[model samples]
Target: MTLTIWIDDWQIQCCGESFAPGDVVSWKLLEVDPEDYADVVGSERAREIDCREEHHGQGEGQDPTPVEVVSVTEVHCRYGVPPGAADTMNCPVPGTTVLVPVDEADGWAKARPDVRFAGYLVTARQVRGGDSDDVSAAELPRSPS
Candidate 1:
């Protein structure tokens, strides 16, 4: 059976309505002012939502947590994306923003064994702290003055 994880933090919302033992809330309330992620939620995030009539995805290898699109860049044009991922996402071209699995980009090639193209190394963004987004990842050499 496909297990559904109760995703807490990064959900960006909470719920006021009470439900029976396993009722799907569908709509949860969040503390964040709606404006904070208005653009994301309205566009990309909305599409990210699964639209099957079942409401719950029972498919193989489905992820339960919510992930935010931090930014989209060519897999090679941008560093930090893991190795072994295909040059397609890494090559200089625009593509759909990918939602990463909770464990980070460790399973790209292993999980998608069927796909030969090197894929992207997706990471969980909503859970990370400050400066992880803004700082450059480059390492500078130390110099003696």
Candidate 2:
């Protein structure tokens, strides 16, 4: 059976290998908890998108799940941190971030030796502090003339 997986940006940045569409990969999958990520992904989205984390460390006895990469999308999320609160809340945005697989009648007709599935990758980008109008050139130290 085909399954939708959520691969976080940090996982790829830390120790994930480069993968593209049509590439069959073996990954350690973990069941996602919708409530845990409801802040970033709205309650509805959290349930739709499955498989949140991929464990890189060794010692797990579970075998890696091999899957074919059907697509890859860069998910852009704009969030806001409430005053006095440390956690960020999701903002109302058009379109859903969840990657739902398209059903193909003949896609899995032939069964392979191993159970292979089709999935997509979602990568998110976050921007932090930077130069702003509040900080003027005069505030910075002068360079040698």
* Backbone clash numbers for all candidates listed: 10, 0
Model 1 residue 93 CA deviation (Å) reads 21
For each candidate, the alpha-carbon lDDT, in order, equals 0.25, 0.44
TM-score, each model?
0.17, 0.52
Question: Which run of 10 residues does model 1 get worst, by summed lDDT?
Answer: 135-144
Writing each residue's lDDT as its tens digit, candidate 1 over 56-124 gives: 223223332232433221112112333576553432222322333332222122322222222222212
With candidate 1 superimposed using the best TM-score fit, by how many Å does residue 124's alpha carbon deviate from the native?
3.4
The prediction achieving the highest TM-score against the true structure is 2
lDDT of 2 by residue, 65-119 (tens): 5556655544334334455666677342333334333332122222223222222
Among the numbered candidates, top lDDT falls to 2
What is the lDDT, from 0 to 100, of the residue 73 in candidate 1? 15
RMSD, each candidate, Å?
Answer: 18.0, 19.9
| TM-score (C-alpha) between model 2 and the true structure | 0.52
